[model samples]
Target: MIGWRLSGALVASGVLLALWWLWGANARLSDDLAAERAARLAAERSAVLARRVAEDEARAQLQGERLNVELKRAAIGRSDPVPDYLLDHLRGLGVVQ
Candidate 1:
């Protein structure tokens, strides 16, 4: 009877330890998955932000080119006799002063 009780206790302790170890492993797996998801989201957001910044930079460059063209046209027009079209454009820009 004593031997039987001792064997039962040992078996119970082994099962309990195994269950604890499995639970710890499950917890670790859950944490790793969560971390991976967060990293993926951060990367996706960063990619989107980078794309938006590039688009903004392109728009700004186009605007700068447009302004430079307008300035050159105005400068050339001013050096010559003003035509109706150039006078109208200067009026539109409120540069009559």
Candidate 2:
């Protein structure tokens, strides 16, 4: 009878210890999942910002090119014949009919 009681106590203690370890592992995994989610959100935000910056740069470059074409046109007015290079540039910009 005493031996049976001792064995029962040992089994119960082992089960309790296993439960405690499982709880700790679950908490650690939850923390890791939360950290991964945060990192993904941060990366998404950075990608959006990078795309905006690239778009702005492209817009600025296009505006600069258009301004240069206008200056070239003004420098050689209606009285002068348009140079072949300038005509090609205007055609490339879809400005020449």
Candidate 3:
């Protein structure tokens, strides 16, 4: 009878240990999944920021080109008489008013 009682206790202990191990594994997996989701969100935000930066750079480059052309035209006009088209444009801007 004592031997049977000992074996039953051992079996119960083994089952409890197995349940504890499985619970820990499930908790660890849950944490890992949450971490992966956070990482994915961060990567998406970085991609959006990079795309915005690229668009801003392109716009700046286009504006720089336009300004360069205007400066060159102004420099040329300084050495010659102003054309009728420029006078009309100045009037449109209220610069000649």
TM-score of 3: 0.61
Off by over 4 Å in 2: 73-97
Which digits, one per residue and each the tens of the lDDT, describe model 3 over residues 1-97? 9999999999999999999999999999999999999999999999999999999989977876665466467668754555668768865855443
Best by lDDT: 2
Q: Can you write out model 1's per-residue Cα lDDT over 1-97, one digit (the tens) per residue? A: 9999999999999999999999999999999999999999999999999999999989977876765566667667844445668657856865442
Candidate 2 global CA lDDT score: 0.84
Highest TM-score: give the candidate number. 1
Off by over 4 Å in 3: 1-8, 78-97
lDDT of candidate 1 vs native?
A: 0.82
How high is the CA lDDT of each candidate model?
0.82, 0.84, 0.81
- Over 1-97, each residue of candidate 2 has an lDDT whose tens digit, in order, gives 9999999999999999999999999999999999999999999999999999999989977886875676577667834556779778867976554
**Residue 71 of model 2: what lDDT?**
57
